[model samples]
Target chain A: MLDLPTRHLHGPGPSPVPPSVLEALGQPCIGHMDPAFMRVMNEVREMLQQVFGTENEMTLACSGTGSAGAEMLMDNLVEPGDACLIGVNGVFGGRLTDKARRAGGVVTNLHADWGQSFSRTLIKEKVAELKPKIVCFVHAETSTGTLQPFEGLADAVHEHGGLLVMDCVTSLAGRPVELDAWGVDAAYSGTQKCLSCPPGLSPVSLSERAMEKVRSRKTKPNSWYLDLNLVGNYWSGSRAYHHTAPVNMNFALHEALRLVLEEGLEVRYARHRRVHERLKAGLETRGFRYASDPEWTLPMLNLVSIPDRVDDEAAVRKRLLLDHHLEIGGGLGALAGKCWRIGLMGHGATDEAVDRILAGLDAVL
Target chain B: MLDLPTRHLHGPGPSPVPPSVLEALGQPCIGHMDPAFMRVMNEVREMLQQVFGTENEMTLACSGTGSAGAEMLMDNLVEPGDACLIGVNGVFGGRLTDKARRAGGVVTNLHADWGQSFSRTLIKEKVAELKPKIVCFVHAETSTGTLQPFEGLADAVHEHGGLLVMDCVTSLAGRPVELDAWGVDAAYSGTQKCLSCPPGLSPVSLSERAMEKVRSRKTKPNSWYLDLNLVGNYWSGSRAYHHTAPVNMNFALHEALRLVLEEGLEVRYARHRRVHERLKAGLETRGFRYASDPEWTLPMLNLVSIPDRVDDEAAVRKRLLLDHHLEIGGGLGALAGKCWRIGLMGHGATDEAVDRILAGLDAVL
Candidate 1:
């Protein structure tokens, strides 16, 4: 065994996978099309729908990570020359823009500051003007740890004849994501983030309206591996042979989703919020300020500015990891060097995990 | 935990994972950017280079199944309108054709019978005629269990100033895949096959020449997620942040690759051959005819026609799974219902597994 380091995963994601889920992951490998494994797939689908708060029949896990789900949604719904209005605030939204353009969509990006959420009124205006085939937003901007509220934006996009596609990669299961009630046409998330599963399978749900758009596409999706129609058939009734589904990964996700439902969504969200509040108070006492806007800060992914007393942020982080065995994310892109992202997500969202990070920070500082 | 019915996996892929690797997978989930995990990634790269028998520094695991590797290569290397002459024999070859088309390649399919290898002269003639930019072939077609000799074909493609790309998904560790010796510009495989890990990660290697072609692409590859340049940067020295990699899956692969190297490649290949021979003798005694071409049949995956006596093949397979807890693959596409595909891959390619399958088949018969 390659030196199994005991890391307190306080990073963006994989946020400390639970023991039961890990046990589930280690289950014997079986055929993807096996009847028994198929039952696990069916259960996983059912659980994913519950977590996503969607009644859509097209809910299933894609074979890759969160970005694969992002690519899948864009590749399937946004055909060549189809107009897409994307909210660009952080890394994930920028990634959406890139994915949409790659899928041959005529993309119009509405920019927001990295640490701030998109202005709902601005998106409404853009959607009304462009009347795009799809309106894309990142519900939780992981890079900047900002949560964009989609209260009125969904209705505005749908009214303008656009499908509402949201990237809930960092928010699903840990936050409120009412897909059916909020009128989300499509949404996708990674298992690692809030689900606390290893980062492989992507839990995705699509509304009937989104499926209709995908089915009516003028051409096949850009990547055959991520084509929703092919993957969906394998997940749903037809069970057609697409690529061999990741069997053990599915097993892991099945148990992770089970744990999520077992804990209950409302309780899970409250736990995240509780830990976030504790961490926020702890950081404030230690002279750290929230990097993301206070009004839109994500409960799970807390972005904080490096304190003035810390001369070398990298050195401090390195020492914390080396001495304390705590792993927190250094910022990405614009936030690099200026901030550190501390995640209290899924199984990591506990007073114990918060205490560990806070104690590690105190020691390092 | 979900009921994980113990199965003796003899499917085309997702061969039974060993206990140690599963334990490694169950190890504590860490941050993808953690230094310890980075070390694992580095070791995986080094071991993959050895297994592939290639000096290509670009070797790394893509974050998906075998088919994701297919799409990545097609999307990155096969530019829009570039002539690609693809060999079509089984489901994998057909998949390659679809992926290449989606990547905007001007595809010219050279068809061979499903259970037969492509004619060297025909491929040579086609290459000379089309002088395509990329010459694609499946090194081992899993659907038909036929091994197409890539020897001499690489020189032919290179002579026409083209690159050779091979799909070695089911052939990698169990078979002799001398990527550098054969002068293959690019190749991809799955962990579930001969590696006998799980089915999420795709181990891919690209020659510098192939990377150059990818670098010179006019448009970004059709996928932002599977973009080789970005993923490669993460694996190589820069270690740029890409997607949150499947952390525990990488751990599983790291241990699996260690196991592969410990056994040594030649010993592993011989073991697969030894079990294949034993299975072949038992199968022949039971009056099962090899469906794949005898001269080129893959030792790892044996595709054999069900005997005349077996009227309900599906019932026999179901009983084998339900009663004896042994699982083998049914034929796909053209060979469906006509044949049964039995795999002796990776950790599952053992005398014990072979004996178990044989006994189960006899009991069911």
Candidate 2:
């Protein structure tokens, strides 16, 4: 086996997985249809409901990464020629637009600056004008660390006769995501971001409203592997086989969800907030500035502008990884070479990790 | 964490993950774009080339299970109204037809009885008559334990100006699959079967002809996550960011491929055959008959007809799991409750494993 170096993952995702979850992942493999594994799957579903703050029965993990969740939602929810309006604030929203268009939706792209969130007024206006069947946006945009406010957007979409789909890839476990309270019709997340698990499975939940659209679709979902109705049947009590579940990955996710519940959502969210403040203060003292607005910034992913004196962003990142054994994400797409993304997610959102990253940046910069 | 029982996995797929691959999985999580991780990816691609006996540049692992690879290939290769012919002898072939139809292909499914392989003459006739854009079939049908021969089918498809896609999910690491020699345009496999890794990613390879088709597509693939063009960019020298890869799962796959190369493909294939023969002989002595034809039965998965005395198939499988701590698959689809699928794949194809399973079956029966 190849010898792998230990890394303190402060990157945009795959944030350091905890040892307990790793142990769970390394457990002996089991059959996907095994009774014991089915029990584990049920527990995972229940825990995901708790974490998502919803009573939706169709809460389960897709067998791929977070991007699979995005494709699954778009492919199943958006039918041919269905008018869909999307908030294109960051890379993820842009991705949604691409997926929606490919799924044959008449897509209306609403643009926002790289580091900004979509205003509710703009979304409401678009919903009224476009009369879209689905209104989609990201809850916590990973590309730009923006925490979009989603309080009345669902109501706006519903009033305009549209379902609401939210990409909560980076927000699910680390923040308050009240799906029912926010009236979200559908949402998706990843395990690696705030769940302190490896990136394999995507946890997705869809409300009755979203399932109704899927049930009444004129054509089947374009991707059979990601057909939520078929996948849901397997994940539901019927347990009909769709495809072989990633057994060990499910084990890891179950443990990760357990850890999240053990810490409690409120405590975990407060911890993330507290660590972000400390890191913000430390970075400011070192002459670094955040790229996103303070009110819309995500506590888990801190997007910061690259200092003017740092001539080589890649060099600084390399030095940090090589010398300090740390990993932080560089900018992507429009922000490439212009900013840095320092993630404080799940296990990585700790005081020690923040101190190490701060010290590493201080030494490298 | 839940205390999971140690199981001897003899299922149709997810045969058994070796200790080394499991150890690799438990290693510290790293960034997907980390230089070290990139090196691992490169090595995995090279090793897959050796295993598939092809130098296709597009060979890489998909971010989901084996079925996801099927979706990816069909979604990318088949555009709307594209003529596609699929051989449906077993569950996997039927699955391909479903995925192709969902991808908007004009599908012509050629049917065969369960536990049988498609004849090359029939495929050639179908290709010539249908004038399909793509011809698809499964090489090793896991559900039926039939190894379909590929002696002249590729030539037939190529002669008719059609791209040939093969599903090698259960054949790649355990059997001889000459993609270049057989002229297969595209093929895909799962890690868990003979690669001795968990089921989280699918290893896919596309010939130049396949990539050319993908490049010249008029419309984008429906499922963005499974689009090979964008995913290939991330796997290629460009190393563009597509999505967050399953970092640790890739690590496990890399280690598993290393083990396959170390054993060498010829030797591994011979071992699978030898163990399978021994298990078959033992089962025959106990009055169990094989479901598949003797000429086309796969070495990895042995589908056996339950004896008349054995009234309850589920009861025997449950007893094997509960009493013997062994796991085997029951029949699926048309063969449901009529047979059992005992696998001898990768790490689970050892003499000790075969002996233990036989003894366990004897006790349970």
Taking the candidates one at a time, how many backbone clashes does each contain?
0, 0
Strongest candidate by DockQ? 1
lDDT of each: 0.91, 0.91
Instruction: Candidate 2: list runs displaced more than 4 Å.
Output: none
TM-score of chain A of 2: 0.99
**lDDT at residue B239 of model 2 (Cα atoms):** 94
Residue A139, candidate 1: alpha-carbon lDDT:
95
Q: What would the per-residue lDDT of candidate 1 be over residues A120-235, giving only the tens digit for each residue? A: 77888888899998998999999999999977777888886889999999999999999998999999999999999989988889999999988877789888888888888898
Model 2, A48-83: lDDT tens per residue?
999998999999999999999998899899999999
As for candidate 1, its clashing pairs are none
Candidate 1 matches the true fold with a TM-score of 0.99
> Judged by lDDT against the true structure, how good is candidate 1?
0.91
